[model samples]
Structures are given as C-alpha cells and as structure tokens.
Target: MRVYTLFTPSHKGLYEDYFLKTLPDEFELHATELFEQECPTGSFYHEGWDKICYRKVELFVAACEESMGEHFFYCDVDVQFFGNVVDLLVREIGDFDIACQDDVTAYCSGVFVCKASHTTLAMFKAMKRNYNREDQTTLNEHLHMCQHKKLSPAFFTYGRVAARPWSGERFRVPENVLLHHANFVIGVENKKQIMDYTREKNFS
Candidate 1:
C-alpha cells in the first residue's frame, strides 16, 4: 500500500517539520505541493479548495496506476497518523473500493483509503460533476453508489470542536485514534498548537 497527501506552498514547512515526522516508515509516502493556476468559473469552491481537492483525487488515481498498488490512502495535511495505518487498513478494509470515517451525515473525506480499479476511476469521474460542492459531499454521493467501507469511530476522530450528537456537548478528540483530522473549524495556528501538544504528550 501507498500513502499520499497534498499541501500548498504556504504549509510546506508544516508538512516537512511536523506531518512527515508522524508517518510510519513502512509504506511509501507521497506529498505534492499545489501550484497556482487560474481556475475556470464554477470549477471550484471558495478560495480554490475545490480545485485542490479535485487535483488530489486525480493525482492519487494516477499514482496508484503508476505504482500498480492494490490500494492507496489519501489524507489531508492536518491529519496526524498515530499507528501503522496501512496495517490497520489491511486488517479492516476488506474488498472495498473506498473506506472512510462516517461523520453521521457524510463520510469524512479528510482521510480515506481507495482501492485501484475501474469502479474507483468511475467514482472520481462522477465527483467531477460537482466541483462547487464540498469534496466531502461529492465523495459521499459517489460512495453510496459503489462498494465502500466505513472505518470505526475508534480508528478515526475529528479534532474540530463542535456540538456532539450523543451528548450535545462539544466534541473532543478520543484517545489512541489511528488518524486525527484537524479540520478547518479551527485556525491553522491553533491547529499546529494542538498537534504540537498531542505530539509531546501522547505521540512522544
């Protein structure tokens, strides 16, 4: 298996200094930096998020094909890996075209595993139909049409502070999650602070 991620030029330092340090050495890791480009009207979400998201998907698919990897995992830069995620995926994601954490309303796209196949390619094509929608939403729509798996909540958790459905209290990061998604709810500086704290306390 292979792992992939995309980062912008502004966050290159974060990827090199922090995110790269958290990755296990068992699998090949690929990180690509985004380049500036003039996007066509209606081709992206606010501030080029959609374009980057689309590019990530395209690049992931190409990488899988080039490497002939059976499966590949893609994650946002804000995610920190705590364990050998590829091993966990091998044990858990059996025969699924894609696997992601369910965020109740939709599967969180921040971290996901995809199997290389015609079906996976078709799903990416379908997602391109709605470049204006959030990537998570587009992914959910296509996932529902294909064979996909949902990772257990214990394996993945969101770091964003929000109202919890179970207790109606603010959400908190659970202990020992394989992947922690520091979504855009908090600012980048605070996200880095949280990651630094977690690394020192739990990951160290």
Candidate 2:
C-alpha cells in the first residue's frame, strides 16, 4: 500500500517540519502541495476554504484514478504519527473497501484507508461532484455502498481529545495514541501550538 496526503502552501511548514519527519520509513508517500491563486484562504467553512476543498476533491479523485495499489491511505498534513499505525490499518481494513476515522459528525476524509478499485474511484469521483458541500459530506453519502470500518478514536485521534482537557470531552487523551489529527481548532498557528504540545505529551 501507498500513502497519499495533500497540503497547501500555507501549511507547507506542517508538511515539512512535522508530517514528513514523523512518518515511518517503510511506506512510499505521495505528498501533494496544492496552490490555488484565486482562493488564498486556509480557514475552514469560508468560500475560499470551500474552494480549496473542492480542488482537494478533484485532486483526490484524479490521484486515486492513477494509483496502482490495492489499498490507499490519506492523511491531512495536520496529522502526526506516534506509533506503527500501518500494521493496525492492515489488520483492521480486512476485506473492507474503506476504513475511516469516526469524527463526531461524520467520517473524517482527512484520514482514511481506501481500496483502489472502481468502487472507490467512483466514490471519490462522486465526492468531486458535490461542489456545494465539503468533501467529507460527500464521503458520508457514498459510504453506505462500500464495506467499511470505523477506527477507534484512541488509536486514530483528534486534537479535541487533547486540546481541551478541561472540557471533559468523551474521548480522553489516549496514552498510547498512534496518530493525532490537529483539528477542531482554527488557524495554522493554533494547530502548530496544539500539535507541538500534543506531540511532546504523547511522545514523552
């Protein structure tokens, strides 16, 4: 299997400084640095951000179309690795076409392992067509057709699990966290700050 991830120029620091360094040497990683001259925003849920999401969908579909592997992995640049997640994914994926991180509202498109078959190509292509909504919504719509699995949050975690220890969220900080996706907060600097502490906390 191969790994696929995308980041914009705005997030180049995260890609180079954290993501590239933490990844295990075993997997071949295809990192896409996307640039959109028109929409120069990185904050989520805004028009510029929505445009970026649309472009991200187009690229993901295109990349999956050309990939020759039997299974594919996608991770957002804001993510960090702490353990050998590849082994867990290989075992958990089993015969499923997709294995997703169960974010509170929906399946997180940020981190997932998918089969590189026509079914997945079709699913991602369908995601490309939903221009009005973000890519994750489209993923949830098409997920019903594919055989899938939801990875436990402790293993593949979200930043909220670490960022707000006082909020008393359902998911506590996992002591042996395998991966951490720095989301549920805004801006790159905020992400960097949380990731710095989260990585230090977990790595130690």
Candidate 3:
C-alpha cells in the first residue's frame, strides 16, 4: 500500500510536510504537484465554467496511470494519518477501489484507493470521458456508474476533521480511519490547534 497526493501553488505545505513525516517509513509515498506550467490552461482544459474540475480530474487520471504501483491512493494534503493507516487499509479493504463520499453526504474526493487493473483503468477512462466538470457531480456520477463493477467503496470518512471540544471523541475515531485532516479554511486556526494536540498525544 502506498500514499499519493496532488497539490497546487494555492495549497499550503505545512500539512503535506506533516503527513510525509508521519507515515511509516515502510509505506511508499508519492506526490504530484500541479502547477500552471504543467497545466497551462489549454493543456488540461479550455477556459470556461468547467475548467477547474476538468483540469483536476484529468491530471489525476494521468498521474494514476503513470505511477508505478499496483494500487494507487488519491489523498488530500490536508488529510493526516494519526495511526497505522496502511495496516488498517490492508486489513479492511485490500486491493480495491475506494472513494470518498461525494456532495453533502460529507467530504470530497479527498481520498481514494484504486486497483490499477484493466477494469479499474476502464472506469477511470470513463470518468474522464463522461466527466461533468463539476467535481461533486462527476464523482457521484462516476461512483454510481462504477457500482459493484470495478469501482467500489473502500471507505468513506469525515472531511476536515480536527480534535475539538465540540467534536468530542467522536470525530477522533471513525468507523474507518482511512484519512483525517482539515480540507477547507473555515475554522482552520482552531483545527490546527486541535491537530497539533492530537499529534502530540496520538500520531507521532
């Protein structure tokens, strides 16, 4: 099992450095930085309302294909691992395509596990071809299209998790601790504090 992440200039780096430091040395870690140079507007997308989503998904598919692992995981930089996540993932959902919950269902496509098999590749291609160019909308649509087929749910986790009095212990432990960290900027300072406290006690 390996870990993968995508980032742009806009994304901050403390969280990425933190995660790289935290993962066990045994697990392979990979990352692809998406910059304007590589994704010059015309390369990934034509300027339009859908440009952002199209560019992101297109880049993701390209990276997954080029990566040299039998299994590829798409993880958000903000998502941190507090425990031995590789062990947990192997134990629960080995060699499967796992996706995050899309839309108001909670979370974004911040994490996913792909098998890299022929069928899985086909599904990914389908995603590129049928992409609605609206992340949530396209992802949900892809999830449905891949149902019980190659693409299946490996796990769904809460997005932007941070230890807080308001969160109680519930947010700290999930039914599945596949990924945990802050996604959006709202409540970030507080989230950072909570994350720091948890890392001191739990992650390191």
A best-first ranking of the candidates according to their TM-score comes to 2, 1, 3
Which candidate, 1 or 3, would have the higher lDDT against the true structure? 1
Question: Which portions of model 1 miss their true places by more than 4 Å?
Answer: 37-46, 67-69, 159-172, 200-204
Of candidate 2, the 10-residue stretch with the lowest lDDT total is 163-172
Q: Residues 19-119, candidate 3: write the lDDT tens digits.
A: 56666665677666666433233222334426545655775676567653565566665556655655554443453454443323443565655555556
Tens digits of per-residue lDDT for model 2 on 19-94? Answer: 8888887668888777653346576675577766776678678667777467778888888888677778877788
Number of the top TM-score candidate: 2
> Which candidate's lDDT is highest?
2
What are the runs in model 3 whose C-alpha is more than 4 Å off?
37-53, 67-69, 94-96, 99-107, 147-178, 184-194, 197-204
lDDT of 2 at 90: 76
Clashes per candidate (backbone, < 3 Å): 0, 0, 0
